[model samples]
Target: MKTETGTPILWTAADAAAATNGRLPARLPAESSRAEWQATGVSIDSRTVQPGDLFVALRGPNFDGHAFVADALAKGAVAALVSAVPAGLPADAPLLLVEDTLAGLEDLGRVARLNFRGKVIAVTGSVGKTGTKEALKQCLEALGPTYATAGSFNNHWGVPLSLARLPADHAFGIFELGMNHAGEIAALTRMVKPDVAIITTVEAVHLEFFANVEGIADAKAEIFEGMTTAGTAVLNRDNPHFGRLLAAARTQGLGQVWSFGRHDQADARLLDCSLHATSSLVTADIRGERVTYTLSLPGQHHVMNSLGVLLCVKAAGGDVAVAARQFSQIQPIKGRGLRKRVPLTKGSLTLIDESYNASPVAMAAAAAVLGKADPGAGGRRIAVLGDMRELGVQSPSLHAGLAEPLRLAGTDLVYCCGPNMKHLFDRLPAALRGRWTESSAELAPLVAAAVRAGDVVMVKGSAGSRMSLVVEALLALDQSSRAGSAVAALSGS
Candidate 1:
């Protein structure tokens, strides 16, 4: 069905009500004919609701989405899905009443998956899931209408929300599944039921919750639980847990297991690659055919993940050549290796914002990118790092271990924050130490002040560490300096 705007209708009131076992608004008659009333999209946040969206009022520990029902309607939401009737809404407000809003969302997602007539792929790993999912989306969209999870929406609620947003006529669907503990992926994967599953590579992330990396591998292996016997499992060949994940996938009855890496026996094997500061040139034997492409995003991690993405495209019967060609168009998103120049008085300082999240492996990758960067004349490589969270008892040692990578990266100056980061700061050479603070808030200004016009600064930390504060501080420097110059000019005039 299409709306008057020629947009494809995503859901009808009748179909949605039946899908979620919800009751229509009281004002509507039991058999009222409202087939013409349809939604063009689905949204969970009231602030982002579009004109013809079905806004699901999800509840969380700190907040209830029901409170925003009226606001969502005012902002053009066609109807609000709520478990309880919110007070202060108009008498004729459109609402779909359900026993539980979250369960209702799950129902919508399950029904959508059941109705979709397309190939589905699920991605899960300690890192690179979002990048791989986004890459696949770009490659598949070149062939036909493709739907994928937005950003890193791969949790329990996030997965269902992404699934519920799937358009009815998409040719391919990709979902990223993430877990901090065992059984989380099992629950999410069952809902996705992807035909192909990709485990990018498991690492020592979220180690606080598990006994060791092996436990993390077992938890990641749960991505195979929802697959049928005929599905394909894509494993990372070079990772230490490859055998464990492969065994689990086979035991779960997956029909095909494909591997990608520099290893000799990898199905999608890397033939050659050059990692530059902002891009990578790669030649790989994908399945059987040798393909070469220049990926715009740098780093070996990205290079390896690209092989998995192309293998997925081929596994789903997409044109490998076309998919390989699409790699050049991909760029890094913000807080994920996005590079920009901030104007200073003499020259501009390069800023690499990797402040979104961090783990040991991710930190090393970011540092490698920093190592390749070309600092301006008389400039130096600088790293402003925050704590890598959830490392448990290994947190201190792991934190200190980062010293080697930073030193090898030729980092001229280093600023560290958080209690865990103190270990790393102490490990750095005396000449490389810029400052160490108990928190990022205290560390931000010092790093911002120390950056010179010719320097290149990279800020990175876990989400909980609030390392973005340092990036914000560094960015604000340009504006403040410009303001000061303007004021001086006005005074002279």
Candidate 2:
């Protein structure tokens, strides 16, 4: 997708140096003007650098990108952005020096955003930020060209990097903003200045850094800091802090505010929803119009999140009908409700990969999706959950509370990892407690052994717990099984 304006060609060596405040070791050759350069793209990673790209050497926590400057240059980076010139770089190489490469990259991104003329949508929440953002991208892409943050790139560096990467001719832009502390979203949102801001929902996430849920809500509200004066603010009417968040939007002088949920007054209200084995049929009242559609993805939480996307698309000057029809193409992202098939001796199995990240609220939602999963024949519902991190003193209670939902959802088996998850394990009925381990690595083997044909296995956990490793191990077994079959075929031949 192209940005609304043609990509601004800031290709002159002089312009690059000016962007970084004359931080270059030497001015670019006088003859090298914008007309002489043609950039295919830009990148911060040396490994992914393409020919004629500008490489940004940022210093990360564990590794310094400056170390890869030579490799990037050798791989065809036309220029480099660094805090200092490399030890032995040629004098003729284009080098833009700055006080901090990361900051300079952000500044360049800001400049790029200033030149972008398309509508921008910013998404954030304690959970579902990535899923909701992807949904919005899917819907908006149907109407015209669109640009969205790649994967879960919604943090400080990620936001700027995504913005900077925005092509100059896209009709729409979608960005996801995430934060764990106060003022982080405020700073990032300012850089985005979204035309329509969506708060998926606020929950007791990252409580380790806050005194209470209200504090978390305050942090999420900071997303409005960069909203345009006439922008639209989309909030979840079902959330307890809806009024508070609404007030925050008003204080920022938002021209329009839309609510999505089952609330009667919600601008986008859920009229009826029927959960199926794989997906949900949702009928919603969008500004008083009754519209029914089936989401290709599972989970009622996803349906709820889609309402925000619908309102956002309308706010961004897109056709609601076209956007609504695009839902069929929507699929769950990796480690976030993405399903896979595993072959077993008796039959095939279904694996729901929700191992990306989790919280108490998200755990309950996932368990509900797992409970509703349909096993074709003689199959059972299974849940493999890890600790919901950052719950502060409430970690034990919150973890234990999931047992009730697990039971209510009729999950046949519950496998848990992490010390915090032990609280839930203790609370589960003995019949449902399939397995438990102190770590995901130790638990993955037991899970692989337990999963059988006709079983719907759903795996979930916080990112820090490395629950995705369990998913990887399970998939590895599937791959190995396939490899063995191929070997047998060759031997038989």
How many clashes (backbone N, Cα, C below 3 Å) per candidate?
0, 8
Q: Which predicted model would earn the best TM-score?
A: 1
Local distance difference test, candidate 2: 0.86
lDDT of 2 by residue, 288-342 (tens): 6677888988788999998888999888998887898888889878999999998
CA RMSD for every model?
Answer: 1.7, 2.7
Give me the runs in candidate 2 sitting further than 4 Å from their true place: 1-14, 23-36, 483-493
Model 2: per-residue Cα lDDT at residue 255: 87
Candidates' lDDT values, in order?
0.91, 0.86
- Which window of 10 residues has the lowest lDDT sum in candidate 1? 27-36
Which number leads on lDDT? 1
